[model samples]
Target: FFFIMNLQQITREKHTYMLQTGDLRQELKKQEGYVEEQRESLFSRLVELEQSAADYCEQIGNFHTNCLQTVSSMKQNRESATENATKYQQTVEDLEKWLSS
Candidate 1:
């Protein structure tokens, strides 16, 4: 009878331990799922941030290109104006010389 009681006690303890282990396994699965979800969210956010950064870089490049074009056009206009002024000066000198003679 004592041996039977001892065996029953051991069986009950084993059953309780199994239940605890099952609960722990379920909890672990839930934590793993939560971690996966968080990782996916972070990955998605990173992709969006990278795309936004690329767009900003493209806009900056376009702005710089426009500024360069404007500078080039301004330089051409300055050269043309200088040439016109030189011609006008020469014409004035010729008029003065002809009038004096």
Candidate 2:
């Protein structure tokens, strides 16, 4: 009778352990699902951030190109003005020489 009781006690312990293991597994599964959801949300946010950075880069490139074009235009205008001034100076000198003669 003691042996029988001992065997029954062992069986009960085994059953209890199995139930605890099953509960732990269920909790682990829930945690894994929660972690997966967080990972997906972070990945989506990363993608959006990358897209926004790309847009900013494109805008900066466009602005840089526009600035270069404006500088070039200003340089050309300055050169043209300098050339005109030199020609006018030469005309004035020739007129002075004629008047002195």
Candidate 3:
């Protein structure tokens, strides 16, 4: 249909960008300025990305340390509780033996 015909017609036309001889120097100057600007922008973005990565790494390290500490405390509490229970049972047996005598 018209869509297919238009596609063929557009391809027939040549793409052109004419840089005049007199304007060459000005164009080159503008290109150099643009390249410099892009370099600065890219450098700043890289620094920001690196800083963000460092911050995230620090936070992850802190979380890992906290988890280890919590686990260790939990283990200690379990051991203490077990020891206390064993002591209480021994006391109870001693009292029963005395009553029977």
Query: Which candidate number has the best TM-score?
Result: 2
Error of 1 at 61 (Å): 2.4
Instruction: In candidate 1, list every pair of residues with a backbone clash.
Output: none
Candidate 3 worst ten-residue window by lDDT: 13-22
For model 3, the superposed segments whose C-alpha errors exceed 4 Å read 1-19, 91-101
Q: Give candidate 1's whole-model lDDT.
A: 1.00
TM-score of each: 0.72, 0.74, 0.64
Candidates 2 and 3 compared: the better one by lDDT is 2
Q: Which segments of model 2 are wrong by more than 4 Å?
A: 91-101
Q: By TM-score, how accurate is candidate 1?
A: 0.72
Question: On residues 1-101, what C-alpha lDDT tens digit does candidate 1 reach at each position?
Answer: 99999999999999999999999999999999999999999999999999999999999999999999999999999999999999999999999999999
Which is better, 1 or 3, measured by TM-score? 1
